[model samples]
Target: MEVQYRSQFPVCSFRLTFAVCVCVRACARAQVCAGAECWSVHSNHTSQPSVCGHDDDAFKYCAYTITYMLLFPIAILSNTGALVVFFWKCWHRSSAFSVVMMNLALSDACFSLTLPLRLAYYFNRGIWYFPDWLCRACVYGFYLNLYTSIFFLTVLSMLRWVAVMQPLRPQVEPVRMARVCVGVWLFVGVASVPFLLNGVTQR
Candidate 1:
């Protein structure tokens, strides 16, 4: 009886181990199925599992299309509207208000011009097909415009404060406003000189 029991113990243990393995496999399959269903319901955009360091052209295009289409239209419409308003106000009644508005509009327009190149860059994964000088110049010009816009806004606020507080004093005249705008632009250009010297082929 002892010999018979010892012989049968190994068979019993093997059967128990097999049963546990089967149960675990079944549970794993069920969990996988449940996860897939949950994700399917939650996500509208379907994508393959990402492979690390893989340059997926399809995913790149999907992202690029969404970003470019949305941003380009908004930039165009908003900047164009601003430009029209600036021109209208400046032509009829040029003041510190008009100067700041015009400067802001110019900055937006200048920044808008770079969107195409930026969109192109996304499509090509940071590759630059445009001229090196032009790209650097664009970057330089964008920053210059931004800083100039900020400077004008600050100046505009100061002028408005002075005019409101001291009504007897003369307001910011057109000639003086023009001079300040020109000075801002000139300083911006000089500040951006480093970009022109650096060129565009920055890695």
Candidate 2:
């Protein structure tokens, strides 16, 4: 009985080892097959952003082509139309309300100008195609618009309150309104100075 038991133990161990080895090889082969399938799917798909993960040359080209040829032009045209209308109609007006609205429009214009660089970045497959300084300048310009919009909106609200509660009080002159608008813009610009100084490159 002892001899039979000892012989059975070795056989059991051998079977266990064989099963483990087979499972490991099957898992490895499954992984390889899955990787190949992914590569094939990527190769067939034309417009995915290859920069985020895959490194195929064909995928990169398709991604750039779609981004530059399709999206960038639309953004530029829309923003340009906005700027033209704002300058022609809004900027020439004199009321405190119009003044704040103009500042908001101008902030939007400045913000829109920064999109071309982003378009270029996507066109270049997540790469920085422009100079390092331009990248920094673009980001700084974008953030400046944020602060400008906020400041101008605050001014607008204050002006609204004064108009409602104190309409009987003497109205602000056009010249003074112009000065307040200019001062608001300048103050917002000054507040954004830190972003400009931070060096807008890479990030």
Candidate 3:
């Protein structure tokens, strides 16, 4: 009876080990199947609707298109006409006021030239296919013009105030005004250096 019991113990141990291995394999297969199903469902459901997405929808369709298209030609023509008049008719005046006005016109014209590229970007739904350097230059020129325009406008106002208040004072020398303009250009150029560097590194 003891020999028969000992023989039966070995069979029981083998059966228990086999059942555990089968259960582990079954659980692993079940987990794999579940993971595959979950991945498939997630892939089907999760996707971006569009590249640009909904944030820019209003601007892309309404504001950007309308404003850029409308203003492009108007800005270009007006600024160009101003510049032509300045260079052709008023170039010989040599007044500080005229010099500042010319710089203002030139800045406006440069800003206007960048508008067409911006218009094209808007037309393409904010996609930039141009060379990176050109895009950087456009952006740099835009900002430079913006700040310089503000600066020059402020100077012009100051000059106007002086002219009105101190009516008897002598006018600002052309050489001094030229030096001021050069300083402004240098300052704006230096300020824009960081922007150019950032553009080169970023996308």
Tens-place lDDT digits, model 1, residues 1-203 = 12111110000111232354455455545554452433332266765453223234544554554555566667677767777876787789887667666666677677667767767876777678888877887778767766876786687667667766766776677767878888888888898788778775464
Task: Give each prediction's root-mean-square deviation over alpha carbons.
Answer: 26.8, 25.8, 31.7
True lDDT of residue 82, candidate 1? 70
TM-scores vs. true structure, each candidate: 0.62, 0.54, 0.68
TM-score, cand. 2 vs. native:
0.54
Off by over 4 Å in 2: 1-93, 123-125, 200-203
**lDDT, residue 172, candidate 1:** 74
Candidate lDDT scores, in order, read 0.63, 0.57, 0.66
Model 3 residue runs over 4 Å out of place are 1-56, 200-203
lDDT of 2: 0.57
Residue 21 CA displacement from its true place in model 3, Å: 71
Residue-level lDDT tens digits of model 2 in 1-203 = 12111100000111232354455455545554353333333556764432224334544444444543553455456546655654565447645555556556667666666766765776566678677767768877876776766776677677766767776666566567668778877777777677666653453
Best by TM-score: 3
User: Order of candidates by TM-score, top first?
Assistant: 3, 1, 2
Error of 3 at 130 (Å): 1.0
